[model samples]
Every structure is written in structure tokens, then in C-alpha cells.
Target: MTERLLAFLILCLVAGAPFGAALMWTGNLILDFVFFYPLFMSGLWTFGGLYYWLHWERFWPWSPDAPPPTLKGTPWISILIPCHNEAEHGADTVLSALNQRYPHVEVIAIDDGSTDDTGAMLDRLADTHARLRVIHLARNQGKAMALRMGALAARSEYLVCIDGDAILHRDAAVYLAAPLVDHPRVGAVTGNPRVRTRSTLIGRVQVGEFSSIVGLIKRTQRVYGQVFTVSGVVAAFRRGALDRVGYWSLDMVTEDIDISWKLQRDHWSIFFEPRALCWILMPETLRGLWKQRLRWAQGGAEVFLKNLPGIRAWRHRRLWPMALEYCVSTIWAFALALSMALWTTGLFVALPGHIQVETLMPPAFTGMALAAACLLQFCISVFIDHRYEHGLFRALYWVIWYPLAYWLIGLLTTLYGFPRVMLRRHRARARWNSPDRGIKAPTS
Candidate 1:
């Protein structure tokens, strides 16, 4: 661990020094890109969201009242909830799955070596709900392994896996499976994820984060005929598709990303199912939030390297844009870092009023323009999910926290994760730690 830490530090310094010096040279150009990039991303998302929402039937053909069309036998789906130390909310998760309105469904709840009472909760629930199956591991392997165990035991052709803490929408399984059953080539479907814990300002910010950024990007990725990955929170996959892609990777820090890349590279189609919603709790503290984002970013970098060689093949042409998008995002992250450093240095060593902070920010209207973009994106997102108006519309007074918190968090995680991922080419360890489950109904 010590050696790896040293190597990561060396990599960061070696990379940061040259970029820092260059930013001091071309200061103005970098600032323009920083301001303009948000607008560009917002535009892409706006177009993508409108296109996907307007053309909803392109993915989900079955109406809300209609059941999914199945052939021959009963169309069954196994809902896998992989948990570790989630006993606090394990029952809630299982109850949500058990409450799924889909007629033919089972909940496979795995208690992954939790030191808490997670296993007992599952057992008691299993005894009550005939559709619930419990698997208790003696020791905590990682989430990927736990999911694999549940998948292997599932009897259905269609499988949906969500985090142990996620509360599934009453009809999530039906919506998630519509595309898969309707379109034979569709391998996996990701649902629209909403924030559950709004007890603190941090949780409220994540509500907008999901709707404004995460939600928009998934829609846009769908418009392009490929999404980087399925949402781990509530994604459904066909067993045949899982077999083709060799199932989820046990060694990946982010199995969700690894599986996404594998499926896309193999020519399997992935879709976003907005009607299939899952409400999840998020970290309400900065420490927890930073760790969560860092882990996610690290997973992206790892998946990028793992699939870098495929770019040379002619069949992998569709995947090139995804790779380019991540790379550009990394560049944007570094550019933001550079802009900040230059601004900081100017604060100390400016030539008597010559250098100003605006020198690093856009010349005019960028702030107002960016704020407008955020509001516009939020409004569009909430329109698709009107039930959550209080999370976005009513919270607009506090929405300003989203950009300030997200920008800093995004930049730092990209910087930190990129270096660690780069240095980890030789040796990378996969360890999973559960985040704060946040307020879980105040425990009676």
C-alpha cells in the first residue's frame, strides 16, 4: 500500500507540474473552454432528453396498464438485492421488491457477510414472503461476487439487480423488462434513479445532481444508441446476455461500468427506462460524498484502460465516441484545475490590479448563462418526473449549491481517480466499503 501510494503521488506531481506551468502560459484560452464546456454539455443533454422523452415509445412500447408480452411460459424476473451491513434498511429494500406489482417476480436478497443483522432481516422476510429468497454469505466477498451468486441461483431468464438499500418503484420490473422482451437485441435496461434521503442540504443537492446531470447524460447516451453502463441501482438484464458478456467482473471496483463496456463492445443494445424508477439514499456529508464520487470516477478510469485495446478494431467503431467523451471529460477536469491554480497565483502575485479573477472566468454572461442552463435542465427533467417537484422546484432556492458542490467534487475526483487509475496499471486492488445509508425512516 505504501509503495502504491508513493507511485500515485509521483504520478500526480509529474502530471500536474507541466500542466500547471502551461496554464500559466495560456491562461485566457483555458478559462473560455471551462465556461463554454458546461453550455455544450447542457445542449447535448437538452437535445437528448427531449428526443428520448418525446420518443418514449421507441424503447417502451407497452402502456403502464398493459402487461409485458411474453411467449410460451410465464415471464418471470428475479430481483437481486446484494447487501453488506445494510441490516438497518435491509427489510425496507426487501419489502419494496416484494411489493413490486409485477405478477411474476421473486426477490433474491443476498446477505453478504454483514456483521450486522442483515441476514436475519432477510431470513424473517423470506419466511413471510413466498417470493423472497435469502442467501447469507459467511464472509463478505465484494458486491460483484454476491450478485453473481444470486444470479447463478435465479430461475428466471430476466434478472434485475439493485443495491440492497434501494427502494424499487412498485412497477419498476415491468418497465425495465419491456424493452428487453420487446426488442430481442436489447441486453440491459437502466432505470431513472432518484434521491431518497433529503434530510440534509447534501441530500437535497444530490436530488438535483441526479436529475440535472446523471439523468440527462443517461438520456443522451441512449440517443446515441449506447450508454456507458447500466445503473447498478436498478438495472435489468437477460440471462442470455449475461452469459455472452461472462457476467459481472468480480475484480472490478465498479462492476457496473465493467459490464456496460463488455456488453456494448459485444454489440448488445442498452436502453434507459425512465418509467422504471428507484429511489436511493445518498451520503449526507462531504466526506461520504467525496468518497462516493471518487470511487465512481476510479471505476470509469479502470474500465477505460481495460477496454483501451478494442479501439483499434473496425467492429468497435461505435465505442470510439464513448472513449472520446470520457477523455474529453478528463481534459475538462484538468482545465478546470489549471484555471483555479492560475486564479490563485494571481491573487498573490498580480501586477498591481493587472490580473483579476475574471481573467480566469468567462468575460461576460457566463455565470448567468450557466445558472440558466441549470434551471432549464432541472425544469425539463422534473417535467418527466413531476411527482418529485419538491426535490427540484421547491429546492431551487438551494439549487445553487448543486453547481458549487458538484464542480469542486467532480474536479477533485477526476484528478484523484485519474492518477490512481494510471498508476494502478501494474497492480490494482478491488475493495468495497459501504457508504452511509443516510436517514432510514428514523428507525421507529
Candidate 2:
């Protein structure tokens, strides 16, 4: 609790930085920053995505749905599925991995001390398939530890890790491992995650979120020469790279972000592979969505805080852009939050002359500019990804809610997560509590 208190205190200091400057400068500057940062980021991502498409993605020779060009010799690869109470989706997920079009692949399923029949079911699947192996943990260890064990036991140089509930595309294995096999310096390849839980409005919007926001940002980051993080749900790694970085940090709440930083800091390259598609479920309800996003926000904060000390080095110069962006975004979250609070207080009581209530929102012209930028970004990202996402245009209506959803969600999560991350001590092992994997349709 003391840790939490310190975290809150630190957050107040960080948030207060803008307001403190308001006394020297005008409060208008803070409001302008709050309004313009999102607009600027949207524009950057749109242009970056367009650049990647024109120069890189559009010219790829292989079909998205077919196997990539065959190599001289098919090197062996291992698919790692770490599960925690995933009985309902385990079998189908394993089957998809086993059925990969790539010929030389082995499937390893780790049942991370599931209370349900997850272990028994994995064993049952292993009995029928010679290439499938099952590892049972005596108790619940987190996803990072489970993955660490699986990677250590993997018999191949290339490894693809997916969530227990995700269905890997038939040709995903080859597309993922191809980068590692072809490029000696490439450390990891993050795949495209398509949402399969579209039974609800929230789930439907996330599908577009993956394309417009998640997918676009990755392409942009890769173009910038550093990735913020790999898609944790499905990413392929080079065993040598993992070994060098000491594998995933067991203490991190989000291992993906931590490992991404580790590899990049060590001068290993991470690639974004659009053809390696993985279908996965997402939260269909608001409560579930909030929990999932909260965890993600906390994980991001943890990574930022843990890696804060290393950025001063001259050799880590490439990481400065990403680090500065994170700092600005965190400060922006607090500034926006403060603006809302002051605006609400103004409704009941008058605020000072310098802090006019009208400043709470962008002027009509600025609003239009932001809207135009967001629309361009959405259009470009969705258009580029349309081939990978069938019937994607139909989701355009749902995506209209995306910009607002992301803004509000991003603001709240950062405010709530940053402090907790600041005060928290590292744990011996990060524990896993099963997440909301969305509502699966009934299978007759």
C-alpha cells in the first residue's frame, strides 16, 4: 500500500509539471498540447503506414493465404502454446498448429497449472500426434515462465509462440520463420492478429482496432527502425536471440514488451510480418475489455520504468524517439485528465480568467483538423490491410468509434497504471490469472 501511495505521489508530480508551467506560461499551451499530440501521432502513423505499403508491403511476392517461397532446406521450427485454464479452446488451437502447411514443425503445449482439465486434454492430444509434446507445470506459473521452459526445451532454432486460444493460420508458421531463416540479424517476427469474436459490438470494434491502430503502429515503428513491442498473442523468435537476452523476464507483468526492448537494446532486429496471420478471441464486454486494457497499460508502464535508466547511453540513441514519445503520452494523459477535472469544477464554480472553460475543447477548426487526420489514418490502414482482413470494409462503421475509444481508454489506463508501476517491487515470479477470452459460439 505504501508503494501505491508513492506511485500516486509521483503521478501527481508528473501531472503537475504542466500545471506548474501554466503559472509561468499561459494555460492555453497545456490545452493546445493535449489537443495536438494525438493529431500529430495520427498523422505520423498514417504517413508511416503509407510509406511501408508503397516501399515494402505491396511488393511482397508470396500470397497472404499461401505458403511463403520454399527455402533450400526446411529447417525445423517449434510452436509454443502456453495455457492457463484454456480447456474450451485448447484442442482446436493445438490442431491448427499441428496442421501448419510447413512440413518440419513440432508443437509444444504447456499447461500452466490449470485447475481445469487443460493438462489432461493436452496429454490426450499428444497421444495421437507424434510431433506434439505436452509439458505440465505442478502449479500455476505465469506465461513468461511457461514460455521460458518451452523455449529451453524446444528442439529447433526457430520458435513461434501463440496464446492457448489463438488459431494459427495454416501458412503462418512458414511466414513467421522465414524472416529468421533468411536474415541472420532478425531476432523476432510479430504476426497479424485478426479478431474472431465478433458476436458483440466491442469485439467487432477491436477487429478494426487491430488493423487501424495496432497493425499500423507496428508498420510505422518498423519503418522508424525500432518496434515498441511485438504482438504477445503470436510472435516468432530466434532461439539464439532469446538465449542472448536471457529469454523473457519472468518478473514482468507483460513479458512481450520487456523482451522486445531486451532484443532491440542488444542490437537484434525485430520484424513485422503481415502475412503471418493468427486468429484470436478478444473481450466482448466492457468489464472484460477494461481489465484486459488495464493489464496492457500496466505492462507498458512497467517496461518503460524498467528501461528508463539505459536510454542515456550513446549506443542506445535509436531508442530515444520511442522513449520520448512514451513520456509525452504519459504526460498528455495526465494533462487531459486535469483538464476534465478543472472543466467539471468550472461547471459548479468559476475558474480563473486564464483558465477559461472553452479551453477544455479544441476550437472548431482544430477539431476538424484532428478529425481529418484520424480519418486519413483509418482509411489508409484499413485499405492496406483489407486483403488480410476479409470483409474489412463492413467494419468501417464500427471503426468510427475507435478513435474516441482509444483516446478515452488510453487516458484512463495511463492515469491508473503509471503510479502503481512506479511504487511496485519486482516479484519472484509473475503469476497468471486467466483473462476474458471473449464468448465462443456454441459448437454442435
Candidate 3:
């Protein structure tokens, strides 16, 4: 029975890949027709253009007209900052948390065995700030482990995890916690992360991508109460929920994703609050950006494989939508790679007739229209994001190159991730390599 079950599972995977590929091809073809037809492409482009248009208003920061909520008697919040060789920015992150307008907050900066001056900095920060505390690890551990330790040590009812490189806005904590006041079922709330450095072209492109893809999609998902992953840069969780989920899983590279999945399994609703913003420094160079995205892609694959069974077994009707979105998305990566191969090969094949270039013009025109529409979509997102960040000149320049860069990056990372997941070759423990920090030997 065991052998039979294993064979059946392999067969199912084999069958699913081709079926998924066909579905993706069909979906793309339909999209092409709807967004590229000469008569309809413009209209569809205008309508599809609304995603970015809506994103602007949807993700704009909280209005001053709307008064801040009166804290429900000041719920004690334990702010967790997982630091790994972030000595340069450690003090800044801690200071940001300590400077929060919200009273009754405990800030815990976990030094995850940094070889640098991070521990000493944390200690110095703790000396001045009464609310600040520090945890020291003897050996280097990944962010997941650091977060788990911080969560376990939290004395408050609520926990807020912020990356060491992230700077929280004054109202960030208050905005993140306000949701819990009304929604008892909410287990976690993700704050918006804005790009702090748009000085480089790569940073500018990422800023646009974040606004259009991550920011917009997350808001839509939030509307449905089905946010997939909480931003690791800044997110708040109920201590009870973290305890119930056994804290962050150290096995996955993307601990944020793993915890979100676990929370969903435990029937906890995750929310995306655009009102709360955390400023983060984006990768300034292409090499740095590539490494950052590659880690995310690999981590996504790791999480999907680790939680596939539980996700499939979920009983809620909403779980199907979530699962389908995730599974189909991963499978579509392979399909896209395959389609690119076909398109490349097709260019070399020739027919033995008078080649009417006009015959191919329709598809070419369709492709161009689709591309233009996609660019317009990005422009809309940038406009919305710029309302808060104000990098209009840089954003407009980056928009032209973003689509191609995004596609190529996705393709390369997904290709690299697919085989690693399939062969079960990834380390169960999350790797602590900081891709944003240039790959260099750390000096003590």
C-alpha cells in the first residue's frame, strides 16, 4: 500500500504539470486576445488600467481627517527586532521602536550572534531606553530562530516583528494594532513597506514593482481576508496566535510565509493595513537585487513543498482559492519557461510559402498592446505609491524597464527554484546569508 501510494503521488504530479501548463497557456492566450485586439486592447487596457488606478487610493496612508483610535487601555506590545550583523542600523531600528508615539511598548532587539558591534549597540540602546531590552545568542542563527526566541520572551499580549533595517513611522505601531480592536479573529496584520532608497535605478524599479505588484495585490487579498504572506519588514501578531502556531518555523527560508500558512491552518485571519508604513532600504544594485529575489523565490518554493499536504487538506471553502492560486502560480512558472522555449524555437522555423508578414502582424501588434497596457498598469501603481514616497521622476524613468526586468528575474529564479524543490535539495534550516549586503567576509 505504501509503494502504491508513492507511485500514485508521483503519477499525480506528472499529470498535474502538463494539465497546469495547458491551463496557463490557455489563460495567457485569452489574456492576449482581451488585452491586444486592436479594437478591444485599448478599452481593455483602459479597464485593466484600473488596477493601478485603484491601488493609488486603496493603499494611500491614513487620512488626517480620520482621527486616530483611542488605544484600548494601552495593550502592552513587545516589539521584536531580529538582528544578524546589522550593527550599522541596529541602533536606528531600536531608536525607531523606542520613539513610538504609542505608550506601554516593550522593544526587544535579539542579537542573532552578529560578529559585529550589534550586541554592544543593543546594550547601549537598552541603557538609555527603559522599554528597550536585548537578547544575545552565542552562535549565528537564522532570522526565524531569532524571531522565535524574541516571541517566546515577549511579556506583552501582542508582538510586533520588525526587520533590523526597517524604520517604523511614528504611527506605525498604533495603526497596526488598531485592527485588532475591531476584528477579534485577526491573528496578524502586515504594514506597508516603502522603499527608503530610490537613489539607484534598481531601487527605483523595485519601488514601482512593490507599489504595483506587492502593494496592490496584497490590498486586494486583504479585501477578501486572504492575505497570503505578511511583510517581514513590519508585521504584528497576537502573542497567543504565535504561541498556538509554535512561533516561527526555522526550517523555511521565508519564515513569514511559513507562519502565515500556519496561522491560516489554525483559522486565523491575516490583514494588510496600508495605513501603517515601514520604510526600508531596497537593494541599490542589480546584483544585490537579483540575490534578494532569488532567495525569496527559493523560499517560496520551500514553503509550498513543506505545507502542500496541509494546504490540500484544508476544509474551508476559501482555502481552495488560496491553494489554487499558489499551486497554479508555481506550476505556471514551469509553463512560462516552456512557452519561452517554444517561442524562441518558433522564430527559427520557416514555412515554404510567400511569407506574408501581415499574417504575423496581428499577434505582434497584440503583444505590443499587451505590453503597453502592462506598462500603463505600472504607471498607475507608481502614481499611487508616489503619493506617499514622492519619487516621481525616478519612478517614471524606472517604469520603462520594470516589466522586462521583472519577467526575466521571475523566470531565472523560478527556474532555479523548481529543481531544488523537486529534488528536495534545499536545507531545512533557513540560511542567514544577507543578499542585500554585498557578499563579503564579515570582519569581527
Per-model TM-score versus the true fold = 0.88, 0.95, 0.83
Write one digit per residue (lDDT tens) for candidate 2, span 203-280: 889988999999889999999999999999999999999999999998888899999999999999999999888999
Which candidate ranks first by lDDT, i.e. highest? 2
What is candidate 1's local distance difference test score?
A: 0.78
397 in model 2: Cα distance from truth in Å? 0.5
- Two-way lDDT contest, 1 vs 2, winner: 2
**Model 1 ranges with Cα > 4 A deviation:** 1-25, 57-73, 346-358, 387-391, 425-429, 440-444
RMSD (Å) of each candidate, 1 decimal: 4.1, 2.5, 5.5
Q: Which stretches of candidate 3 lie over 4 Å from their true place?
A: 1-67, 343-362, 437-444
Worst 10 residues of 2 by lDDT: 435-444
Q: State in Å the error of residue 181, model 1.
A: 1.0
- Candidate that would win on TM-score: 2
TM-score of 2: 0.95
Error of 3 at 343 (Å): 4.3
The clash count for each model shown is 0, 0, 0
